[model samples]
Target: MARRNHTTELGSIACDDLTELGAGKEGWLVDNPNLLTALDTHSLAIANHSVVLVLDWSDGSDPTGPRVKIRPTLSPIESEYISSVEWLVFDDIRVLALGTSCGYLLIYSLRGDLIHKQIVNPGRILKLRVRGTKRDLTEDTSSAEICVVMPGVVARFDGSEIQSMLQRWFQETHSQFWDQKKNPVDSGSSNVRLPYQLWNVNKYGSCADAAITGIMPPPLMELQSSQRYYCAVTIGDDAVISAFRLAWWDFTLC
Candidate 1:
């Protein structure tokens, strides 16, 4: 198993301590790092601090082929800090979803373009995952969703709907900025509201005092028509596990 130290102390180390430990120099450390393979498996993303590294491994299992660096596009006065990241792929499109310590979720295309950004939580996001299956003509189904997991809350959003909203937002913002007759200040900013269904495991009668830390959707087989229903599971820091069932209709939770 791969292991890494996640602990850090603010105090300085003595020279004698370094000499006793092979005289090594001090180095920076990462807290709560995350790594995951994209759905395609040909790509991998690693997040540390305020940057994410997207690596392609198509050329014969080589670890060093090409790397793309992705960073949050913040205003000059804003700070950039990433806490987690996940891959979101739909049909022929692939994008990276980054979660920040300040409750911001930023989505970026493979070419490092900022596609969409929003604040999904009031606290740090602990985990993220893209749920739901692609549109299937033979099965006559369409269900694409994104799941955002944070302390004490699990928010679900429709993936296709979000994509549509972002496209419209980009066009309107661009036109409003260039129209000199209209006051740029009056153009008004777009705030993507939480078009999400939230699940609070804490309110579900769990005795655990800790907040929710992770969540996952039912497996694909369980989501099929044969199952007749869909479910999700959430984990809490205090070792409490909660499961929820929702009626499925036309690829949505009813």
Candidate 2:
């Protein structure tokens, strides 16, 4: 009931368990090749369009045990379907983020309450990828970034922006501890505008999916420019697989 990608180290539950998508349902699994879901040690949160469900693996660990379903909070009567989900666990913060068809990021608390929302793109979000890198002894490869991929665009959000905003959000409510049982009284004040980097990557045709794997060191013998360079890998029917060097000016690596 799992699918493994050796190249990206990405593993997904194929189908059969029930609380979420991986419960042996080939039809559902086959239809959702990208899979709108996020899996963590304690639970699996999966979405079908706008409907979201959280399945706790360790029943006793969470009081809302087994199953907790959530419908993203949108403007009254507004319809926005979820395209991707990502779980962020940093320090004492454990929250769920949903990427919507309207290119919005909706962050929710464990209790299934919306905490924050930010517009990321004008197009539907294809996927939300959360990555954290460790500092190597020889190089400064440490960085935490969320890769938000759209059809022909890719954006990145710094981990620090999210970390601080969540911290500030809880503080605004005068609560040092996160309470899963109730919604914060000051929830309205938590809408934060975070700065992000967006790049148009239409060089490889319209990409079905894409992510910035890492910040590469400058090419050998090349002067290190102020701009941080990244390698963008895109998947599409036209190219199957295409690689591009993303800098101030785009460079094709194919």
Candidate 3:
């Protein structure tokens, strides 16, 4: 982990403390009253963080601009390769969920201790979301509930059989991602637009070219007209912000 320290005397720092990093060190530190509660492949949903947060690159504007800092009092997650974090809608509150490269889906409390750790193997979860498919005009609309999209497949969790299905989907999916030529087939010329249309785990099958290629689908789809999704904001291993339209899944209404 990287380390740096700043000294404060009376809620303010001496100007001499500003060395190479910048004068706006204080500006980079914002407080979150609440943090995210859930994690999936695409993004983490946070609570008590802010009503509306802007994720633009700061160019390291220290004490003069807005930036955020993790709760100094809290310990970081034990795992190092956390790919993504998100908030899931639970009852009336948001919960933080973390996705790890070691195929772990960890649920944590606001204080950041692991509360639930489920092994979602094979594929590393890059995104997660709930689908409330709207009914077609020919079908009844009142009987619908939400379904979960893990990595390669989507399924309705009944508190029993869903986890098993999700595990199978995630593993096969990861295997497929790692084994590139087996899935993509034709490389750049291939027309296999992803996110596994209809959850077919092995459309191509396992092969020799398996690696962590960064090519994947868009993060979140259900836009809600007013929400924002954050992507990488920098070049070559940096964070960026991107936005998209959230389309309501239409075929699953039955």
Query: Which candidate, 1 or 2, has the higher lDDT?
Result: 2
Q: For model 1, what is the error of residue 38's alpha carbon versus the real structure, in angstroms, after optimal superposition?
A: 5.2
Residue 122's C-alpha lDDT in candidate 1? 70
Number of the top candidate by TM-score? 2
Question: How many clashes does each candidate structure show, in the order listed?
Answer: 0, 9, 37
Give candidate 1 misplaced runs (Cα > 4 Å): 1-39, 59-66, 73-80, 134-138, 165-194, 204-230, 245-254
C-alpha positional error of residue 148 in candidate 2 after TM-score superposition, expressed in Å? 0.3
Give the candidates in order of TM-score, highest first: 2, 1, 3
Q: How close is candidate 2 to the true structure, as a TM-score?
A: 0.75
Predicted structure 1, TM vs. truth: 0.57
Which predicted model would earn the best lDDT? 2
Please provide TM-scores, in order, for all candidate models, with all chains considered together: 0.57, 0.75, 0.31
Error of 3 at 113 (Å): 3.6
Off by over 4 Å in 3: 1-80, 133-200, 204-254
lDDT of 1 by residue, 1-254 (tens): 88988995432223232232233434321222233224345676655665566666554644533456665654445554676678876655677887876777777767565666677767777667766664664887766777767776666777877667656645664575445433322332335553665555445553222222223354666544443334556665667777655433323231
lDDT minimum window of 10 residues, candidate 1:
12-21
The per-residue C-alpha lDDT of model 1 at residue 165 equals: 62
